[model samples]
Target: MSLPFNNTCRFNSVFAGVLCTAALSIAPVAFADDGSEASRERALVIVTSDSLETQSMAMILSRAMQEQGSDLHLLLCDGAGDLAVEGYASERTVAPRDIKPEGLLATMMNDGAKVDVCAIYLPNSEYEQDDLREGVGVAMPGPMAEMMRDPKIPVYTF
Candidate 1:
């Protein structure tokens, strides 16, 4: 016997839910490959805020992103560029562990995150190349623009 109209709709909805759940479970494996890192996830994190709290949160999230296996790329601009400066430290510290944003930034860098200062950071600021941390580089607009436009990679700004 055929089900009533409402029952049929209910059955269809249940079927669709199960189908979606199954697809979601397999989606991550679909992006994996054999021992190649190029296929791993990528994300660009831009920090331009001047607020200590904002900078603190940005570094916190960047750490989480790195921990999750994303190839984290950091673009520091404006006041946030201070994070790349050697010996730079914020007056206040974030709670839980009292670590400053600058300290957290260093930790993230040591954890393999790629770091760059915006192209104008040098010309607009008194700090020179020697002032920047050892591995931090000035970003080239050409490559940065390309990465920002890529569909598979996401960009997060704070």
Candidate 2:
């Protein structure tokens, strides 16, 4: 006997097919390992902001890179140096609000990520050596400039 004329079944079947196709398309990106991403080897992220949101996004990206087993180096230069200042805190409540730079520095250090502050920016700032949070290192502009030139290193400036 033939099936009843239920157009709903045809629609449901088509919908299911579309869902399966979408799932297949996305599954590889979601579950695939980072070993195949050649660019994941080394990454450099530059944060030039003291903004909460910018710092937060940088931290999140750094964490993701580390999770993928990439060597991550974060450079804080220009206005971003404010983040490395000890006791620096922002009271702003907004979309770009993020953990204090000092806090992010500590977290990144704990996660085996390197945190560097531009020396050129340092001398001009009010931050003394003692003002910098622990586990953060000094990076001269020369070295940072060179690192930024490396083709393999992906630079994200904020």
The best candidate in terms of lDDT = 1
1-158: candidate 2 lDDT, tens digit per residue: 23554677888999999999999999989977666555357788888887677777777778777887887888888877777777777575334543455565677778778888887777898777778878778897788878889887888888
**Which portions of model 2 show Cα errors greater than 4 Å?**
1-40, 92-101
Q: lDDT for every model? A: 0.92, 0.76
TM-score of each: 0.80, 0.65
What value of lDDT does candidate 1 attain over all alpha carbons?
0.92
| Shift of residue 1 alpha carbon in model 1, Å | 22
Candidate 1, residues 17-128, lDDT tens digits: the string is 9999999999889855654569678999999998998999999999998888888899999999999999997998878778798888898889889999999998999899
Between which residue pairs do clashes occur in model 1? none
